[model samples]
Target: MRYDLDTRNRALTLLRDGVSNAEVSRRLGIPSGTVAWWLHRDRARNGGLPGAHRSTCHTCHGDPLDRTAYGYLLGLYLGDGHIFQSGKHRVPNLTIACCEDWPGLIDAAEDAVRRVFPHNSPCRVRRVGCTYVKVYSKHLDCHFPQHGPGKKHTRHIQLAPWQREIVDEHPWELIRGLVHSDGCRITNWTTRRGKRYEYPRYFFTNVSDDIRRIYTDALDRVGIAWKETRRGSTPYNISVARRESVQVMDVHVGPKF
Candidate 1:
């Protein structure tokens, strides 16, 4: 199986910290052989290589971007992520607020940031209700060109052609990320003729129409049937209620963990 790039990087980090290959494998739920190979590759490549830095960013180093990780990160970005330029150096910090209810998503969001900015270690800050997974780098714009001033809903947000290509190639990863960020799987039930019936569906809610379009466009590419719905005052809810579509989602992007 092809493991996520973030998982590989994580294993390397733990190995460098002097953790044994067995411990790293146990902690990361990766194979012992895989962890050992990562450590071996790191030492072999650079004779005790130093940590990664922003200079290694694909935009600067001319390395191919980790498209699989980026595909998922794109969904998280459009759903509830933000970029803020702070501090005197004006380093942009990409922050994605993940609800505490889904601890799995919190970990997933942090992993995406780490893999995208491989050398940098992201930090998480806990708010009253959600945890903010944040990373600082100047090259964030190169990765997420949709970042700009003003609210996302008030401004126009569009993906670059290259980004669309990635989404096309890894449609399910994008959908999984988006659903994990802003969407949920829910069930509605009723009783009719002395029988109980339940309907399970998936809903993605966002204030930005363009962002919603991005989500739906990906769904179209994956052949998942969806329809527009409303939530309270916002008319930006997309629902996938068809039984067949739910089956596809169950196989690929089930409920948040």
Candidate 2:
């Protein structure tokens, strides 16, 4: 005897409202065994009880997040992270690509994900040149409303007011995450006064103009001066080259160890 969706929902509602399985079955004229089975199935899908999964999602739990960690994760997401929906259940997994050469950064990325997401363990997948740190939860969309179809560059990425507040409060963390994902520190040398000199600079390159703006906005918040440039005809790159600015970057968003 297959029950309609409405019947299942009604039975669930009755059970959630403190009606015993047998009593719900009697009221709805459903078999006691069938009603019990339906409740069990719901529990399995919903992490053992109604709203149990909410405890893992800060937005759903209505609790304050570890916003500093979340802000850094946001930068990583806007830089090299992606979200893919899992199954028909609509839980989305967040994956951030980290270069294989930087083991410390890989560890930091995983640690940050754990700090922001309660009880959810992030996994790492190694690829040709990079490793991906991934964690799955039902409420990723609530955290990252910027997610949508198509490439990120094709979509408009703006932070919500709450997220902007987090970025503003912890601008360096965001900048560090962004630079770790899509930026690097390099040394440019030239012969000056018959001597070789090295100019160490930091550059962040991303294809999305909106993401570029977000990165630069964070830089501005931290009093780091930057210049935007195009290498050839493609790629928007932000450079921190001035002595004062480079010192700031070195202190906060230093080279990946």
Candidate 3:
């Protein structure tokens, strides 16, 4: 039921632009009551009531670094990261769960968190077989506009203008992040005309159509070609099996390690 600052701001903006609360709620997937409450609160604050003030966070300010860090974080978030408000105080926490087998990925995620929020420290939580890199910050939601309730596939996913700018500028970093989280590089062996051959390729799998489109769009931006592979049902896979396509992916995404 907790809404991020970005969501609240977006809802308020839409309302100011003459959008109905029900329409905004339907579009943003926010409850109608929440929208009404926000509008009422805004009106009260504008009325100059005592102790009625707008909340401000780091996002109200500008980003410290360029979009590289944010692009990487966004990819990771779309793949395996999650954000939620917890505790009695309702503090927002961002957690990126990476497989323990990939220590390098864990390290990379931690490094990105540090670079994105130098003031906040990230912690690691060890589950049964996965390690979660977690950070507590209100501003985390600002960087990831795609954060919302339920599974990503069931919800709408769209990149904001700033996010698009980042991905456009550094598609490789975005690809690296997505590949490290949801994709893998492997060597495939096959027999062709009584000959055994080995080839290297990359595979990406996700259930969210929007997320899959984002990944494919990034690949297209980098001039890498990928094709859809039938993977049973639900989750879909994108494979880069062609030699030239594999080469392009290798140059940008490389191996997760």
- The top-ranked prediction according to lDDT is 2
Ranking by lDDT: 2, 1, 3
Candidate 1 residues 115-219, lDDT tens each?
A: 878866689999999999998887888888999998889899998988888998999888988898889999978899999999999999888899889899999
Give the candidate number with the greatest TM-score.
Answer: 2
Better of 2 and 3 by TM-score: 2
Candidate 3, residues 1-257: lDDT per residue as tens digits?
78889999999999889899999999999989999999888878685456544333346765465468767877888999999886664668888999999899999999988877776779999999999999887666777878889888899999988788788998888888888889999999999999999999899888889999999999888778788877665559988898998987777678876
lDDT of each candidate versus the true structure: 0.87, 0.88, 0.85
Q: Please give the lDDT score at residue 231 for candidate 1.
A: 72
Model 3 pairs whose backbones collide: none
The whole-model C-alpha lDDT of candidate 2 against the native structure comes to 0.88
Cα TM-score per model: 0.77, 0.80, 0.75
Q: How far is candidate 3 from the true structure (C-alpha RMSD, Å)?
A: 14.3
Best-to-worst order by TM-score is 2, 1, 3
